[model samples]
Target: MSATPAYRRGMADKDFDFLHGRWRLRTRKLRDVMDPTCTDWIEFDSVSEIVPAFGGAGNVELTSLATEPPQEALTVRLYDAGEDLWRVWYLSTRAPGYMGPADEGRFADGRGTFVCEEELGGRLGLVRHQWTRLDTGRPRWEQAFSFDGGESWETNYVTEHEPLGE
Candidate 1:
């Protein structure tokens, strides 16, 4: 018989259950994520709905923003119980055509940090997604990018999720 992976030993399927609901989103993003001196930011309010799928092992999040032309996005998250990891994929109307790179990670101490590499300004760079304050009843997410293999990073986006009454 094969032994189970150590990371999977105690991991549960309810890891993402907290996301199954509607939320009001306070979002901010840097105007130029790759430019060091571009401190300008755009902030907006939006709404989101997360639906559970795959019998609790996966979820789909749909977001809508009433921007100038109206905007929408979708995020898909899947947890691999046997691998003890979660993978996320995102697509935004702001960027048509291709879905962004996949981010893979597992929760630790009520926080989840996922990482992936993607092209930025014509060069490959590392992108990090952070999930924190999860258990504190105030969940937030941040995104950062690093060109030096994580030796340095600059936060480019943040979203504070406020749960709305059903």
Candidate 2:
């Protein structure tokens, strides 16, 4: 038997490394009534810090648009060595019950995609985030969802993230 290759040596130097530092996210709701028209593109800045407690998890925080207090709670993301993927979980005060679980897929071409498949309001919904880094030190985040078995997709949110000046 042969040993594992250097490139495929678990989650050491994979696409997960691109998630380090800070980012600006554009969140969209594709399946809701308020979505598809309103609140499509909201601007917010986010910072992702590596936590040693959870095996270098990506803990994120951003300002909330609906609230007046300023910022929201920390959304958690973990890099699983077993699956070689990033898993995200977060609790929303906007939604009364249930939780959000998102599975992330990163491409070698400097693009990333995340899909959230979980129950919301007793119904099945799938939300996805498409991200790409541009030449101007800015990244783009787009939100889309499929309700019918990946047959169709609806655009909900689209926002560009510009790097914060020091």
Candidate 3:
């Protein structure tokens, strides 16, 4: 067998290669994203497109949530070769002129978990986004928040990506 390529051997450009394509996102989220006690939930169908950019050093996901008034969201994932980690930034039509504090982490054993601090409703807390089963036909993404400095986490958002025309 030949030696493994550098990008495949360590954290490099190909980390997000599996996500490049079109996807159908079935999303379920809490009505109040910051409220751990909130049980009210909303489900919707969204379409997403992921394109590999910067020669696979990064990727971008554009999602259109089919909710009332029709909203759109964008996620940009960039890999830091030197740091051997990835940083994800998010932007949304739901929030005007906001692109955020990136969640940073590296993928291990087919799972990727990233965390960042965010202020929701005048309260600063920890936000986490996880990507799992990415090598499968159906990959999953989930979001959670913790108010007590990562002591606890409440999952508020989840989406399973079904490959389009697979």
Candidate 4:
């Protein structure tokens, strides 16, 4: 007999429902990703709007950052029904036609961990994005990179998401 919990066996398509609507995001990012000793951090604000698509199997998020020169980005998330996982892709105005690497994972116990391989300063690295605090009114997201094949990680970016008009 299978002992896996039903929730783990089949996650609902609405797993990302909490992310819908408008959010005000505060972000702190490392100024230099390659420098392990770099303590310089850049703080910025951004507004994000997310909407469901593909009959709940997909979602799209548009973000506009309040940086000095202003910045915009889009994230497309598609859920693979066959694998019961979600794949995320990012596109930023700074990088025009280039779509970043895909981060693929599934939410478990209200937390989501997505990982992908990326190139940081001409060196290969493993990137991880984690979503937590979903039960709280304000959810949090963090990004980390590991150069030693996941043996260690350096958190480079963090975003605090506050629901707008709440």
**Per-residue lDDT over 21-51 for candidate 3, one digit per residue giving the tens place of the 0 to 100 score:** 9999999999998666799999999999999
Per-candidate Cα lDDT values, in order, are 0.86, 0.54, 0.87, 0.88
In model 4, which runs have C-alpha deviations exceeding 4 angstroms?
Answer: 1-10
Give the alpha carbon lDDT tens digit for every residue of 1-117 in model 4.
224445645455666778988999999998886799999999999999999998777899999999878989999998876677789999998789998889998888789899999
Ranking by lDDT: 4, 3, 1, 2
Identify the superior model by lDDT, candidate 1 or candidate 3.
3
How many clashes in each candidate?
A: 0, 0, 0, 0
> How big is the RMSD of model 1?
2.2
Indicate whether candidate 1 or candidate 2 has the larger lDDT. 1
lDDT of 1 by residue, 77-123 (tens): 99876567788999988888889889988777888899999998999
Kindly report which residue pairs in candidate 4 clash with one another.
none
Better of 2 and 4 by TM-score: 4
In candidate 2, position 106 carries an lDDT of 43
Worst 10 residues of 1 by lDDT: 1-10
